[model samples]
Target: MTLPPIRFTADEAWALAAALAAADACAPYAGAARTAYQKIAASMTGPVSVAARELAARIVALPSRTDAAVRAAVEEALTGNKALRLSSVDAEGRESDRVVEPAGLLTADGRWYLIAWCRTRRAGRGFRLDRITAAAPTGERAQPHDLAGLLLGSVAAGAARPVALAALAPPS
Candidate 1:
């Protein structure tokens, strides 16, 4: 018996291309689908596709992962599902106390951003990892929130905001 060739629509093809291009392990399949991938990539115009492509470029350009301290903080918060007390300075040079339930960590444009549920603002906020002077586990489990929703909300809320590192601060 012979099987019929499978066919994919433009949307499906585009999704497959993006997935393959975003992963190093899929390089072989990506090479095989080069032509289709290019065509789909070039034709991408939807908001989601455009955002995804832009993010993919940034991820590719990142020099390295977040620093060891930031990585450790994020790991502890995520693993324990706990709130992180962050010592951070805002753009206006105001030092603030922020307790957040970390939702996710993302690297874009050679920087790390932490998406979290801010207890102070009573809303979701994204903080630049470099700007965080210190992060300590609160030892209190976080109140559950929809992490995927928070991340998607961050994208809609403009993930390009300029947040800077605290000047003259020691690592915590």
Candidate 2:
């Protein structure tokens, strides 16, 4: 389906650039969005007669996603229902069918992780969403534990930290 091009004001583009720098996976999308906005700023004819060269300068710089496959993959993963389950390949080359009560999604160190409650283990687990082979919700809801609170007051805190740090952060 063909969609109309997006339009953005100069101010909007500048604001978007600032926001994109702080964002993780969406940075590429932000760049594309900014480009559309810049085009609008140039052709805009009204009382505001801005310089053309300065228009580009106001744009927020972001990592470009030239690969169609990568862009599609990222779009598919992030758009639509954030609550939906996803299937992807994992690190060990094993298919992991997990019923996760997804709490939040995080991208750290260039990898996307789902912070969810794993039904099989009956615990809060961080799954590398990209590695998931397949994901489908069971229509069954599981109680999510406040892992942060539990770990803060338990021995698990020590274990979660590095060995060197764990020794210093032992359970009180």
Candidate 3:
């Protein structure tokens, strides 16, 4: 037997699309919202059904939680000038130690990332919060570093240049 066709008005379709995008944005960070996204996907029947399903799948694949101890340590470090000793695993599966001056914590795509000045590496590094097994205060004060410059430099390198509105306008 064939299923009945589902229909939506143009406005309704636009509203659904916006809702789906919102759900996608929240799903990575919020467990309850991820469940809501699944429910929304279930209700979708026609044109937007595939898009909803894809968004739901993407949300399901994201990491759900950050370690409590690691999070607390990072938060504490953010409030002070002390350096932290972070025990983390590398991409190669080998564990390593890093003494970092905590600059900030950023959440992207449902995961927490630590942007810090790594004294060991002599540069800034972004470490995934989940991978940090342990965080301890070093008691020693952090040296002055250009945290904003490092973060902005990394973003500028890959970001697309902005276009001027006049360039897009046609002369009368």
Estimate, for each residue in 1-172, the C-alpha lDDT of model 3 and write its tens digit.
3346556554554555455454332222334454654555566776567654554345333333456667667766766778999999867888989899987555555555777899998888888877888998888888766555557767523422224334764542
lDDT of 1 by residue, 1-172 (tens): 4334445554564456555555332122223355655565565665645654664465442233334465567668976899999888767878888899987665565446678899999988878766677788889999877655776644545443323323443442
Ranking by lDDT: 3, 1, 2
| Residue pairs in clash, model 3 | none
Query: What's the CA error at residue 115 for candidate 1, in Å?
Result: 0.5
Off by over 4 Å in 3: 1-64, 152-172
True-vs-predicted CA distance for residue 43, candidate 2, Å: 15
Better of 2 and 3 by lDDT: 3
Number of the top TM-score candidate: 3
Clashing pairs in 2: 86-135, 87-132, 87-133, 87-134, 87-135, 88-131, 88-132, 88-133, 89-131, 90-131
Candidate 2, residue 123: lDDT: 68
TM-score of 3: 0.52
Clashes of 3: 0
Among all windows of ten consecutive residues in candidate 1, which has the lowest summed lDDT? 23-32
- For candidate 2, give the lDDT: 0.48
Query: Predictions ranked by TM-score, top down?
Result: 3, 1, 2
Off by over 4 Å in 2: 1-15, 21-88, 147-172
**Model 2, span 89-161: residue lDDT tens:** 5566766665556654444555445556656766666666445545544444445445454334433343343
- Candidate 1 lDDT (Cα, 0 to 1): 0.64
